[model samples]
Target: MLWVKAFHIVFVASWFAGLFYLPRIFVNLSMVPPESVAERARLLLMARKLFRFTSVLAAPALALGLWLWLGYGIGRAPGNGWMHAKLAIVVLVLGYHHACGVLLRRFESGVRQRNHLWYRWFNEVPVVLLVAAVVLVVVKPF
Candidate 1:
């Protein structure tokens, strides 16, 4: 159980690192001036590879989380409201991840629907979600 918990933490941290960074890349991507073909291409490649690697990391993190919750019964009790809140945040995080993919696709298609400032704000979403999740788990304030 401890080993599982440890690995889960590691994977989650790694996944969050990707979540934190990919958006910064998007910010840079959005800021890239037209005619900088090589820079755009390079940024796109980095975003693509990071997204793929981050996705790979997310799978094990989520799987181990489920294992901890279901198999280990970490949050099955009646008073585990913190767990419920954390789960909701997880869903939001997943949605944010999908949104990132969509944004990447749009960028790939040469759509510049949003400015860099918007992406800068967008990049902060996961940070807040991660903080909430960590607090929920560690403090269990519910």
Candidate 2:
């Protein structure tokens, strides 16, 4: 159904938006001086909240993606290379999601230092991967 497709697109967009922004929080957290207790707490709280909200959308996006792939034959999308690449990126994104959870837990437990520049650099990774994914999905460029 067109409505299902629309919901899928909206939810996917929401998920990506959060994915893109999550690392920026890390970047900000890294910039704050290590001794700034209040600032550190605030940053950790923000990251936790954002991750939780984004995860809610992500689960459904994954479910709906699978549903559409099966129900609407998206697996039959013409280009094997593009489809394969997209699937790989999807796995990478999922990895990043789980990694975020792990990283947040480590930080919350005071096992890690938050560095702004490191997070800024980390932010570029998902952006690059997502760009490739978008190209594969939209242009199907081989």
lDDT of 2: 0.82
- In terms of lDDT, model 1 sits at 0.97
Worst 10 residues of 2 by lDDT: 74-83
Question: Residues 1-142, candidate 1, lDDT per residue (tens digit)?
Answer: 9999999999999999999999999999999999999999999999999999999999999999999999999988999999999999999999999999999999999999999999999999999999999999999998
Q: What are the TM-scores, per candidate, against the unseen true structure?
A: 0.99, 0.89
Cα miss at 24, model 2 (Å)? 1.3
Candidate 1 shows a clash count of 0
Q: Which tens-of-lDDT digit does each residue in 1-142 have in candidate 2?
A: 6877788878888988888888888777666676899998998999999999999999888888778777887756665577788888989989988888887887788775656667777778778887888788789776
Candidate 1 error regions (>4 Å): none
Best-performing candidate as measured by lDDT: 1
lDDT of each: 0.97, 0.82
Task: Extract clashing residue pairs from model 1.
Answer: none
Model 2 segments more than 4 A misplaced: 77-79
